[model samples]
Target: MSGPGTNGAAGAPLLSIEGLSAGFDGQSAPAVQGLTLSVKAGEIVALVGESGSGKSVTALSLLRLLPRSAWIRGRAEFVRESGEIVDLYSAPKGTMLSLRGADISMIFQEPMTSLNPVFTIGEQLTEGLRLSGATRGEARERGERALAEVGISEPGRRFSQYPHEFSGGMRQRVMIAMALLRSPRLLIADEPTTALDVTVQAQVLDLLASLRETRGLSILLITHDLGLVSRVADVAAVMFRGRLVEVGPVGEVFARPAHPYTRALLACAPRLGAPRKRLMSIADILAAGDGPFGRTGRSPWMPPVDGDSARGDGCVLEPVGPGHSVAVVEPGEIAAGAEPAT
Candidate 1:
C-alpha cells in the first residue's frame, strides 16, 4: 500500500468533495454544510465526531443514498477504477447503479439490519454478482472465496447459514466480504465496528487495514471513536453540528488540536491511568467563552454564515501546519498562537 497521505498513483485523490451540503425537507438547516474532504487510494480517512455530527450524512450524500426528501448541493468528484472522473452529484442514474456495488460500496453500521434474515448467506452474497450478469455457479464460487478471505472458517458451511445463525462479528465479516465481492476502489464504512465488542472491533479494524494493504483499497471510515482514528486512520477529520472543525494527519491533529471542539473531543476521550475528571460536553466547550479553549476572540461555534459573511461570522479552516488545518472564526488566530491543552 502507498504511504499515508500519498495517493496511489500520480498523487491524485481518489475521491474529492467540496462545498457539499445536505438537508432534509422541512429542516431549517442542512445536516451537512459546505464540507470538503478527500480520500486517496490505499489510505484510510477517518471522519470522527460525536453522534449526530453529520459524518454518516456526508457518506450517504456521496452515494446518493439519502431519502428523496433530502436535498444535496456540491461537487463530489470521484476517480473510478477506469480513471474516469465523474461528478457524483450529477451522475446519471444508470451510472450510479453500475457504480454502487462495482466501483464503490458501503458497509452500513448495523450488519444485523443490513443482512436479510430469510436469505441464505451465500444467496445474499452472490445477489449482486447475479444481477451484474454472473452465472449462479461463478457467483457462488466467488462468494465462498470472499468468505474465506475475510477470515471466516468453513466458508462452505457458513454460506448456508442465515443471519441469525452467525455472531455479530461474523455477520460484520460477512458484510465486509459482500462489500469486497466486486473489488470496489472506495469503501464507505459507516461505524463498521460500532456494535462489536472491543476484541471484535480490533479484529474488524485489522481486517480493514489488511484489505487496504492487500487490495490497495481506499476507505472512508466514519465513527465517533477517537481511539480508533488514532489507531487506524492516516488522516483525521473532525466534525461538529454538521460542519468540519478540523482535519489533518492523525498524529499532528492529535498532538496539536487547534479547534476548541477538537480539543474538547480529545479531552473527552477515555485515557488509561489519567486522573478521572468530568468530561466536558460540546456545549460546555462552546460556552467557555474566551478562555484557553477560545484563544481566538470569538468561539468557533458561532451561528452559521453564508459565503458573504463567512469571514466575519462563521468559521473557516486555517492551516496550522503543513497539511494540517483547523476551523476558526478568525483566520490566523490558531495558526499564529499557542493552542490550549486537551
Candidate 2:
C-alpha cells in the first residue's frame, strides 16, 4: 500500500530524503542532522564518510531498524515497483515487512557475522522465500538458482554446508545471493566489501555493477572508500560531523571539491603514481592558518566567530555546478580573501 507522498514521476528519484535527523535518547547531539539526498532509478549513489559520521545511522533510519531508544525525525520517500510512493518513516509495520527483502534488501558488512553459523547455507538462503509462502522444495530450488546466479559453483552442494565452511569471499557471495533472492528493486549495501582482499573487492563490486545493469537496480552504497566511490558510484554524497558537506556527480566532486572539508578528504586519499607525502588530517586542515586548500589566507570554510556555526544554522548547500552542491557559509560571512571560487 502506498503512503501519503508525491508519486514517482518518470525520471524522478527512486528514493528521496530531506531534513533527516536521528539520535539516541541520551545523546546531546544527533548522529545525523538535516541530511538530504536522492537516488534515481538505476543509479548507484555512494554515501561517503569517515567512521562515526552518521552514514550508517542514516541507512538504519531509512529501514526503521534502529533500536527503540533511537528517535528519528525525517521524510524518507521511496518509490515501489508499482510506481507508488511510500513514506518509509511512517509506513505501517506490515507495509515495511512486505517491502523489506521483496522491494528493498540490505547487504551488511562482515558477512561472517551476518550469516547464521548454526544454519546450513541452503536453509538460511531459502528462509525468506519459505516465510513468504513458498513451499520448501520451491524455496530450495530457487535458492540453488540464486547461488548459481552469484557465481557460486556446485550450488546444490555448497548450499548444504554451513557458513563457517566457506571462505570470506565465498561467504560474501552468499550474502549477495541471499539479498537477491527476492529481486529487490533497491539494494542498500553497507560496506559490502569490508575485509576482503583487493581482488575479491573488485569481484564483488563488479558483481554489483553487473546486477545494476541487468536488473535495473538502484543501489545505495554506504562506504568510506573514496577509491571505491570513484570506481563504481555514479554519484557521491559526503558527510562530515553528522552533516552532509558535499554531493554531486562522482567525476565533478572528485575534480573540483568546493568545500574545505571535501578538499581535506581528497588530500588524505592516496593517489596512484603520485609522489609520497604525509597525509593531512582533517584537524590539521582546520588548524592551518592559511586553510587546507592553500588559499592565500584562512579559508571561509573554517569556523567563523562561533565554532559550531560553521556546520550549524549558518551553513547551506550552494550549487557550485550542475548537480554539484557544497555546504558553505554566505559570501558576507566568509573571511576576506577566502571566498569560494565561482
Name the best candidate (by lDDT): 1
lDDT (10s digit) by residue, model 2, range 95-205: 998888888899876667988889999999999888879998899899999999888999989989998899888899999899999999889999999789888988888
lDDT values for all models: 0.81, 0.79
lDDT (0-100) at residue 86 of candidate 2?
Answer: 90
Please tell me which predicted candidate would have the highest TM-score against the true structure: 1
The sequence of per-residue lDDT tens digits that candidate 1 reaches over residues 317-338 is 7777767887665434332222
* Candidate 1 pairs with clashing backbones: none
Off by over 4 Å in 2: 1-10, 273-279, 287-311, 331-342
RMSD of 1: 4.5
lDDT of 2: 0.79
Candidate 1 colliding pairs, count: 0
